[model samples]
Target chain A: MSTEELQAWLRRFAELVHEHKDELTALDSAIGDADHGANLDRGMTAVLAALEEAPPADAAALLKKTGATLVSKVGGASGPLYGTLFLRMAGADTFPAALRAGYEGVLARGKAEPGDKTMVDALGPACDALDAGRSVAEAAQAAAEGRDATVPLVARKGRASYLGERSAGHADPGATSTALLLQAAAETLS
Target chain B: MTVGIVVVSHSRALADAAVELARQMLPGRELVVEVAAGTEDGGLGTDAMAVSAAIEAADGGEGTVVLMDLGSAVLSAETALEFLPDDVRERTTLSAAPLVEGLVGAVVVAAGGATREQVAAEAGRGLAPKEAQLR
Candidate 1:
């Protein structure tokens, strides 16, 4: 994809987040503090504003700045987790590599793994599809599938873990957001 | 100068109450301590920008040791450290210590003119006393 497409993907992801803010918050309210939507919305707003104020020179710069903006603005675990995703991606040479780096960064920051019912659940499967040389559309589909699968798994990380078995049956808000992000990338980049 | 302490919590009231307790426990010490807790909307969360600013404010040249309340507070504090200048970042330490007890212990150590490492060690050991009492 061209650098312009990458930028558009970011914009489109922001819009997707804005559109799904309430849904995300509702999911979070079931298992979290009910602020995921508002926090992500606020963070993405700052990201777009920063992009407009001082346009990044390249895709890497844009991704890096997006990470920094999220880190500074989005409070709680999502901020650092999502921020680490873009920050790690900024250094990669390929889209797949970038997604892998981003996924690894999330693991390192949150110490979550597949089936943990965190964002890693969706991001991990999406990256796996990408690594298998699948299309972005395929990866996005895998991400959505991963997100749906989390509804039956018990959370083992983050505040949701506090609920133990009770955390089952509720979709992970982070994973849902991750799916939204990948779906946006697939739609905008492809 | 003594080491400074910064408390990062998910609730502004929690950080403030912890700070108030530390100050009361170490009256007359005049230690430089700051709290960075809660989102701008006063929700239960932590902001790295607020954490970074608190660390800067708490620093008194002897370096600052940050105590985080829980999961995201630790992440935010780590992110805040990344924003600091190299020299300041090198001197700052993010303690895995329990927030309330750690802040109190760190305050006492800092008020005694302890170095950053010493204060961090003390703060990290704050839970030891309780653990021992339970034993």
Candidate 2:
């Protein structure tokens, strides 16, 4: 993707994060610290501000800056997890490959699996779809489906895991946000 | 003769208080303790970039040990290692120790001229006293 397209993806994801901020927080309140929405929103806002301050020269620069901004400004598990995603993406040659690398990074960083009722649930499917030569829109759809699938899984990672069976009925806030990210990529990069 | 320490907590006040408590363990000794806590906006969270800066600041060339408050704090501290210089990063350790208790033990051990591993081990066992009390 071109730098402009990547920038658009960031803007789209930031806007989505803003719109869904309360919803994300509500979900987190069910099984977590109830700050995911506010945290990601703050991080995205800073990301946009950073981008505006210095427009990046390439996709790598844009992704690196975005990742670093999130790592610094997000200030939560999401910060390192999402930051690793974009940072790993910065070195990959293709968007699909980047997604794969980013997914692996999350898996490594979080030590979470697809059935862990974490972002991996959504991100893993999206990566699989994209790696199989699916369109970005299709990958986004896969992510949404993966997110929906989280409602039935017991928590196995993250703060949510503390609740065990009590966490089964709640949708994962991280998966919800990851789906939004894939959707933004589909919207802007595809 | 000291292993630097970094306290990563979600609350700035919490980190400051913990540092104070830890520092108190050594009345007149030199203990390198740094805190990377809360967001820049004064919110409750852990900033990896801040943790990275703290790691560098806490390092005394002996090594640095990180003690974190919660899950995010641990993740942020781990991520912070990526931002450190190669040699400095090589010696840094992220201790899976409870915040308050661990910091106190780490500070005490560090002040006594222990290595980073020893300090971390002391921190790891900080929970022993409490657990023994409960038992």
Whole-model Cα lDDT per candidate? Answer: 0.89, 0.92
Which candidate tops lDDT? 2
For every candidate, what share of the true interface contacts is present? 0.62, 0.71
Candidate 2 stretches with Cα past 4 Å from truth are: none
TM-score of chain B of each: 0.96, 0.96
Give candidate 1's error at residue A117 in angstroms: 0.8
lDDT digits (tens) for residues A49-136 of candidate 1: 9999999898899998999999878886899989989988998878889999999999988888899999998999999999999999
Candidate 2 DockQ vs. native: 0.82
- The digit string of per-residue lDDT tens for model 2 on A1-190 reads 7898889999999999999999999999998889999999999999999999999888999999998999999977999999999999999878999999999988888989778888999999999999899999999999999999999889888789899899989889999999999999999996
Q: Which candidate is the best by TM-score?
A: 2
